[model samples]
Target: MVTGRVARITDFGAFIQFENGEVGLVHISQIAHSYVRNVSDYLQEGQTIEVKVLGRDEKGRLDLSIKELQDAPEEMPRPRMIGRQSPEFENKLRSFLRDAKERGPGEKGGKKRKK
Candidate 1:
């Protein structure tokens, strides 16, 4: 297993600088099983991720994988949308907006006045 803080994330891959000063590219294809069109969805600069060393390529560069940590499992459950706010909540929101507008700029409301 290779461990390192992500140096940077790019559409093509993440650049990881190892402790020994060697840097490696963890290609987007290897970040996850799901389609990864944007590498930012899976990684961020300074974020640490564990990678498994698959093998060295013909050029003697390391090939890394993030998916080796797991076996294929059942599809993830879809997130449920919560219920809408009640009428009472809407009434409160309207009151708040009206009050804020009434206060106007330079008042207690959240508006900045020209100096």
Candidate 2:
């Protein structure tokens, strides 16, 4: 683990400078385990942070991750269906499917056929 100061914030990620003058990039996905809509919300310019070195990329640039040092959040519960649908709803769905099959392909609703 090495200490680095955020040098710049961009749409993709943040650039960090180490004590030895080496710089690395902490990708937006590496910033946190959760969804990151904006990089600025998680990091700022000149903010000092501890990062784990993930080694160099194909271009030999340093690859770092802050999320690797932090514990992951608990898994969210999956949503499940609670009850069966009503008879009326089932009837409507069946009717709709029958109408759709009758319409065939590329046929728009309420469109009249040319002679």
Candidate 3:
């Protein structure tokens, strides 16, 4: 873990300057395990923080994460969906189509008795 002072802040993330003059970016998602509205809400300029190295980006710049040092929150269970149609539904649909076809257009009621 490297200890660094907040060098800069942006809507996206914060930049930190390490002791050896190395600077790295900590993305907003890596700042905390909870929803963060602003980077300053968690980190202030000149404030020091401990961050774990998350390897480097394609440009060789260091990538860091503060959430990595903390315990992860438990995932909530999702409700089961019981909305599948039964195989017999196909037969019911066919029956309904056949009945509608038997009932010709302009026919309001089920049947009209012969006068």
Q: How far is candidate 1 from the true structure (C-alpha RMSD, Å)?
A: 11.3
Badly placed stretches (over 4 Å) of model 3 are 75-115
Worst 10 residues of 1 by lDDT: 106-115
Off by over 4 Å in 1: 75-115
Task: Please report, in order, the local distance difference test score of every candidate based on alpha carbons.
Answer: 0.81, 0.91, 0.89
Q: Write the residue-wise lDDT of candidate 3 on 1-115 in tens digits.
A: 8899999999999999999999999999999888888999999999999999999999999999999998888974567888968879978988777766777676655454354
Off by over 4 Å in 2: 77-94, 106-115
lDDT of 2 by residue, 21-89 (tens): 999999999999887889999988989999999999999999999999998888855578779899999
TM-score each candidate. 0.59, 0.72, 0.64
**Order of candidate numbers by lDDT, starting with the best:** 2, 3, 1
In candidate 1, which residue pairs get closer than 3 Å at backbone N, Cα or C atoms, i.e. clash?
Answer: none
**Candidate 2 — which pairs collide?**
none
Prediction 1 TM-score vs. true: 0.59
RMSD, model 2, all Cα superposed?
Answer: 4.2
User: Higher-TM-score candidate among 2 and 3?
Assistant: 2
